[model samples]
Target: MPFGDFQKSSKDIQLLSEHILAAECEVPGSGYNHSEMDLDNCLGDDNGNFQWGGRNFHSHAHNIIFHPDEGVAHVPVLRADLDGGSKQSNVNLGERIGNVNGHLVFRW
Candidate 1:
């Protein structure tokens, strides 16, 4: 397949995962105890934001952040683990850097 198609498909999948994960995160205490679903393995935010990410449990794990429109997409990734758990820790840095949402400057 062409690289463009591949990239689009990847983003599509990312979006889908984000949707499911985001919904799951919304319901309090609705995950962990189930047999069909495993919430512990996911990387998500409790704030119910539309953004979420994750990766496989490997020997070594690093950050994998993807804001989609963000220029770098995933920054400070030490390895290609395909997960954003590590990157979650650095979100404050971005906030410190600043998030210009219309007239609101979401910053520390």
Candidate 2:
């Protein structure tokens, strides 16, 4: 199978974001960019404000970012593997993205 086959497209991701952020999803979230780290929950955001955490299962790269920077007209996904798949690296990545949207949007 092609590696790209497993990759998530911008549209797919957008829908996923919408689904995940939906109030009816039953998953409590801190909006798009707002995040809070909790040891119990295994989420490490350092209290900066991150909406979600993404990890490349194959590469072990950690990614955590906020709302897409619509104003910037670009979508950015911060990936960190400096610590060798360390969960804390995800938190660092989120801090870099800050609270903003990118080019990718649900409506194209």
Candidate 3:
């Protein structure tokens, strides 16, 4: 497959996973507990965000990716789950320092 097609397909799969995660919840009287669903393993936290390509993504949910029309080539993301749950945060983008050891690095 061509690279663009492969990339698009990959994004489609990711989007599907995000949908499944969003629709997942405890079903009352269904004899299945939330733990039984094992959805926690697929998420990094309660925000339904997951880690991929060394960045945080939420598909159609809250995420840190700068879109092409945003005019910014990249934006640094820093996530913190204060109050033991996901909350809105103000972030500042730092200088990109490229990748290191399979990890994306930035200079603050």
Candidate 4:
């Protein structure tokens, strides 16, 4: 999938911000531009409150582990050696295992 596919939509982002505010968590703000890392804007403003943006997102080192639904396979299976016909032998292992609604998993 494309990198942009991973990013949530503007509507989804708005909803998330609203939800966070309602839950009494740190308020979201456009602290820094995504294309340009505005360090000056972030460091200068110190409300003692919490804030997050691309500056932290891009600077921070973090690992994301994507877990598919229970009993759902992540990747397809293919035989390296072509003993049998390529088209006939190759099978999608996930199809046999279970189905995962990607929309539901990634949707807001």
Candidate 5:
């Protein structure tokens, strides 16, 4: 996680930023997987500097298929946005599920 030192806010006029280099997870037993890779930079004198980096791959699919007995879970989050080389905004969160003792918060 690198890139967390740029703070300038005046009610948001394009200087918003975020930084996180790596986040990892893995829990076996047929479900639980996580990942986060980020380096998002947005600066605007007129949207001049726009450096984007992103990778968020998440998974949690227990006993699938509409509550098959005592299981029916979902969490399929995937995002990929890799900067100027180009690979913009790819998202898939189906219904947004996966919070096994969740705690990953960063604010600046």
Candidate 6:
């Protein structure tokens, strides 16, 4: 079979796992929770806003089931959820982080 045809055929009969992970740098000593910052705080007294400096981290996992007989090449039927938290500085100027949890489900 041609390379393209072989590739296509292989894709048609496999269960695949896909994952994405990302992270950013946090502001030094800026320990803040997402819920604590509001419009007022974000927008400083001078209307100059102080944006959240903490890095946002995210991850996603997917399980793709392929069914060639049904004419469906791939179907993503599994997922994972994630959550996280942190703590502020001793001076109370920063914010606090919280807990993180994740849930995974697979559809058979």
Model-by-model lDDT, in order?
Answer: 0.24, 0.26, 0.26, 0.20, 0.23, 0.20
lDDT of 6 by residue, 60-80 (tens): 111212232232533212122
Worst 10 residues of 3 by lDDT: 3-12
TM-score of every prediction relative to native = 0.19, 0.19, 0.19, 0.16, 0.18, 0.16
Error of model 3, residue 53, in angstroms? 11
RMSD from true fold, candidate 5: 16.7
Off by over 4 Å in 3: 1-14, 19-43, 46-71, 74-83, 86-108
Task: For candidate 4, write residues 1-108 as lDDT tens digits.
Answer: 322221221112111111110011111353222121122122111122112221221122112122222224333222111222222222221232211221111111
Model 2 CA lDDT for position 12: 26
For all candidates, the clash counts are 1, 11, 0, 0, 1, 5
Candidate 5 lDDT tens digits, 4-102:
211110011110122332232323344333433232321111122121221221111111121111214322222333333233333222222122322
lDDT tens digits by residue: candidate 3, 1-108: 211111111111112232221112223344322211112233233333333322322322443332211125333233333223365432222222222222223322
Task: For candidate 2, report its TM-score.
Answer: 0.19
Model 6 spans > 4 angstroms off: 7-12, 16-63, 70-108
> What lDDT, from 0 to 1, does candidate 1 have?
0.24
lDDT of 1 by residue, 1-108 (tens): 221111221222122222121111112233211111121233334332212233222222234343433444432111123243433332211222111211111111
User: Which clashing pairs does model 4 show?
Assistant: none
* Model 2: ten consecutive residues of lowest lDDT: 18-27
TM-score of 4: 0.16
12: Cα error in model 5, Å: 20
